[model samples]
Target: MVLRLFVPPGEGQHYIVPKRPDPLGANATLQYVVLSSTALAAGYASFAARHERRIAPPTKVSRTALFIKASGRLGVWAIVVGAAANAYYHRGFTTVVVSQLVQDPTPPKLYEKTDKYTVEDGGLAGAAAGFIAFLPTLLMRRATVPWWTRMVGMTNIGAGTGVIAAHAYFQYTGERQKAMEELERQRSRRMLEFHYIFWDKLLMQRLDPLLQAYVRHNGIFRAYHVPAEVLDAPDKYGILSMPATEPSTTTNAAAPEHAPYYIAAPDWTEHLKALNTDFTQSEIENSEREKEALLKEAEYMAYQLSLKQHAFVHSTHTNDDDRQRCIRELQIMGIAYNRLRASADEADRRIFAGRQWLRQRAAMDANAPKASWLAEHPFIPDPEAHDPSMSIAEIRKCEDQFKIEIQVFESRVRSEVREDVEMRERWRRDLDEARTLLRATDGILWELEKKCPPKRDVGEVEVRASAVEETPKVEEPPKSLNPEKP
Candidate 1:
């Protein structure tokens, strides 16, 4: 059995009826059936409310809606064109039938004289044909039609149908293209956001200490000759491995041996893998040779700069007439110092590049040598493989050169100090004479104060009284004695 019911909008109601049936044979089926109906109704009502909540309201017309609307317009034009074509064909057929009727010579029967099909029938047939021809257009108009229907309709139509289809297709294609572009933009934006967050919060903050420790253990700070201030700058180094509360100074303390020579992100290995090419042992050997040549050139330039500075300092003290010439010599020395510093920097860069190339090459090798060729060379060694102290003999030569430069600098400094001291002593004597003149001026002021002292007027006062006081002293007689005498 089937039942249909309509529930009015915004109103809800339920009906329940209770009836008892015999437990035995006769009404047993009806009893169970009534309970089932009640349960089913209750389930339906509960599910309806949940389903309603799950469905979101439409805010804008979807792509499907726009496509259907566009297809409907295209379908209208198809029907009109098909109808016109059908009408023309029907008119031609009617003309042929009339010509045949006109050629008949016998007396015309009314029914026979009439055309088998009327104009109205022809119009109806044309309309039917036009509607049938517009089947694709109708399919496209349906909201549930698949995406491929639009694609086919747009591709196959000609003239009237073709123009309409092309318009719809262009709009659809444009929207799809726009959507893809927007997706790409969103993806790029997300990647950049992740990059910035990782650099600032994860890599810079969390991993910077490890990097600093690695740099220090590898003697990078000493090799680069970085000043304490530059290494400490947050803008330059990102973070210090040491705690802020601890003293912000690093003395000649030994770096921890277990510290890494390079601290890199987990992905750095993968990044190098993508680079494809790897340096070979021969490449590393060539790099080392280049580095040695650069270093030698730098050392020679440094010696020349030092010699020029010495000559300038010595010439300055020779005579007053040569003072202009000495100043010119100092300028030349300044230029040499700059050139030597540049050469040293270039040497340092070459050495660093060679080391890095060797490291990468070693990583790529399946069975790398125990030590690089640099370490085996007679002039240089792998600092890691052999004790760096073993190279002290080579380092001693550098030390001797350093000591000679230091002695020359010290002698120049001492001479400058002696000249400064003598000039200061002469200035002191001149100052003493000026002070003596001031003292004499003070004495003259004192003598003048003693000879003519300032005075103040004091010690005298004058008073004046009137002479009428004596006349006022004349007295009146006592009243008690005067009564008896009168």
Candidate 2:
């Protein structure tokens, strides 16, 4: 057993037994120890890198610095631990050699050989172990193993660490993908908004002059600012032009007179006035009043007025006094007729303005990017292989709908404006015919006055009073003058 440390002994050599147990522990196998330390070092490096990655900030600088710093620390630790392990084995083997050589009965020549074998075995084992410990560095050198996965080999610990690193990488990529999608969505939304904003702002700018004209042409507020002479002239004619309202004592008598309801151009002026008032109020107030209700009310009022005017104008039986009342009613209609004429002119102007606005904006849109650019952009490949470009479809759909709406709006505005023009022209022709008839009635009244002239000043006043009193009672023969109902 003692020669076992040096050389084998036969016939001349005795079967010697060990005096004491071997100095090195039975379980202290050099190869096993080297492998264990190598695995431990690899695990430590992987764990260190993973922990650092977890705690590090998401910024580029922080992550890059963390990897670089971790690699450096790992290298230093591997070097230190490798040196220590090598030194430990070397010392253990050297000590065993020295102790055995002293106790052995072997010659000095055998001692040199045993000591040489011990040193060489220990050095080789130490070198192999140190190389295993530094295996992580080699793995990290490759680009395929992500920066965070710096550890080498397929040991359980290394595998676990690699899984964690992969998980982190995938998470980062997913977050980046989401952010990119959000950015793309916002870009698409803005592009659609541009379509509306571009046209709407232009329309507003073009309508400024028309808005000023609307205020100027409508006499509501402007009436208050008119010259005193203009006000006085209308008041002077009030006695002749105004309809008299009186309650009749008899049941058969006509009810108290009021202005006849007629849907005329002036009626539209009132409707427009209400619309403008509501529009202005909406800007300044927080009212919840529905626009549709207000519009319906205006429309109903205009319809009722038109019916009343039609009934009065076409009535065939009316005395001189009733005819006089009709003349006064016509004066009110004349005022409305003038307003209608102004409105017709305004409508024509609006049609022209809208045409100009649409023309200019259409040209601008024609110059903008078309749908084909989205399908095959110059910068990117066919986007279909990646995420679907739903934005392109959305834009096209919105654009088509907008075009249809604009066309409908334009057609309606044109039709309505032309109708207003025609209606006002017809009103002017009717007014001329009515004036001719009024002059003939005045001439006949004058002739009757000359034929039955009053005698004296006191008697003339009594006669005038009697004439006014008898006027309402007198009924005229049925005679249709103008054939037209309106």
Q: Which stretches of candidate 1 lie above 4 Å from their native place?
A: 1-236, 239-325, 328-361, 371-486
Error of 2 at 359 (Å): 3.7
Top candidate, metric TM-score: 1
Residue lDDT tens for model 2, 96-134 = 232332333332122212211222233333344434554
lDDT of 2 at 161: 40
lDDT of 1 by residue, 1-486 (tens): 011111111110000001111111111122122223323333443554456444323333344333333444444444455446434432332222223322321221112112122222222233344345546555555444444443322222222232233334534655334333433433322233223323343323433454334324433433344444443342233222111121121111333433321222235455434321211222233345444555566577668767866776665465776777767766776676577567556545545554554565456564555544233356534433433322333333343443454454344435646555544543344334334433544555344334332341110000001222334564752232212233
| Total backbone clashes of candidate 1, pairs 3 or more residues apart or in separate chains | 1
All candidates: TM-score:
0.20, 0.15
Candidate 2 yields a Cα-based lDDT of 0.36
* lDDT against the true structure, each candidate: 0.36, 0.36
